[model samples]
Target: MARCVLQRLLLLVITMTLPMMTMAGEVSVAVASNFTAPMKVIAQAFERDTGHKAILSFGATGQFYAQIKNGAPFTVLLAADDETPARLEREGVAVLGTRFTYATGKVVLWSKKADLVDAKGEILKTGKFDKLALANPKLAPYGAAAIQVLEKMNLTKQLGPKLVEASNIGQTFQFVSSGNAALGFVALSQVFENGKLKEGSGWVVPSNLYSPIKQDAVLLTSGKANGAAQALLQYLRSDKAKAIIVSFGYDL
Candidate 1:
């Protein structure tokens, strides 16, 4: 009968999907603020392709490190710098040999105004801006890189008073976008897409100006038993994730 056939079809569909439903799992991920845009896209693709969910928390790498040390339940960490993951591994908080460099970050002197920043970044020397925003160097690697750029140019002392420090690269970008500061040093990934600035103007800081911002991903001890967490870490190294990272102006 038609009714019997319909019931059988529904049962078959549920039976086929049962394995996938059981395999699907969720993982808690702590991500660096600068990687917000790309990570969102990657997380979406990861879920679509693998049936695993990533619950992301974005913040400064230093703050995340502190939280992880205090027994936060984060299953994985996507750090803005390599040191944090290495330290965590040494401290036995992270799974040994599971850390890998995910991306090399770049810094940019950026402004929301289209013509405010020149290609060569001479604006910093011109001192034309009232306030120059950056992340707190003590907690954010991007902020430390910004300080390095200033020191390399010998403008640290001269520009000291103009500095406005934010808690993280995200907040630093907010400060500039909100016009609370004229300009700020932020991750190039935050403002770039598909080989162009998404908006406003920016000067890409040269690599020689500061230490390489080698972002790394690691599985925390808390994630060792989590299949989703392990799968997510492996996914980060896949070509699809690398392409997403590259589109956002990060180097793999």
Candidate 2:
């Protein structure tokens, strides 16, 4: 009887765990560079709750768009701007009605030095820095926003010569953090955590300076049959993911 009980317990355990093992899957996601930190946290939570894994690739949204157009195998896209996903949807590469704004981003003028950037961003007028880094405006929305900020302040012409362009917001942050550029316009999430700046000094660019950065997420055509991909998209809309996004200083 004890032997039969042991066999029954083993069978019950297998029955309970087999479905989770079979349902667990991996989704490949192309994510914007600015969303990296928060996405990592959310992905972890998603895996824990749903038994699915997220495989993430981070880069400039424009580059990801090009890759998707070329038939990249990405299952989903988390873009820095709403335009790219809408374009994909129009082109029939992404599923219609699957795109939505996940986060609204803010840009900041930041420096590794503790006191280089003033609260009101007077440093842009001061012109004390030799190299000011920003992502390539042609490739990154954050870069375009930075340009708008400079133009609104009427300092673009004066600062143009000192500008150093990076391929993405992540690289832009590296340029400033490495001291190659004294200061740069970067996503606020890069330098903020848990309601405070992680390091250095920064000026939160006023919203009036540029268009809103409405970051969006979408399910790609390649993901339509992917259970993990669908789960991840739904997970992104959950309160858990939104809290993580907010913790990283992004607006919902």
lDDT of 2 by residue, 1-252 (tens): 999999999999999999999999999999999999999999999999999999999999999999999999999999999999999999999999999999999999999999999999999999998999999999999999999999999999999999999999999999999999999999999999999999999999989899999999999999999999999999999999999999999999
The residue pairs found clashing in candidate 1 are: none
- In model 2, the clashing pairs are none
lDDT of 1 by residue, 52-77 (tens): 99999999999999999999999999
lDDT, residue 73, candidate 2? 98
- Report, for every candidate in turn, its global Cα lDDT versus the true structure: 0.97, 0.97
For all predicted structures, in order, the TM-scores are: 0.96, 0.97
Residue 146, candidate 1: Cα error in Å is: 0.5
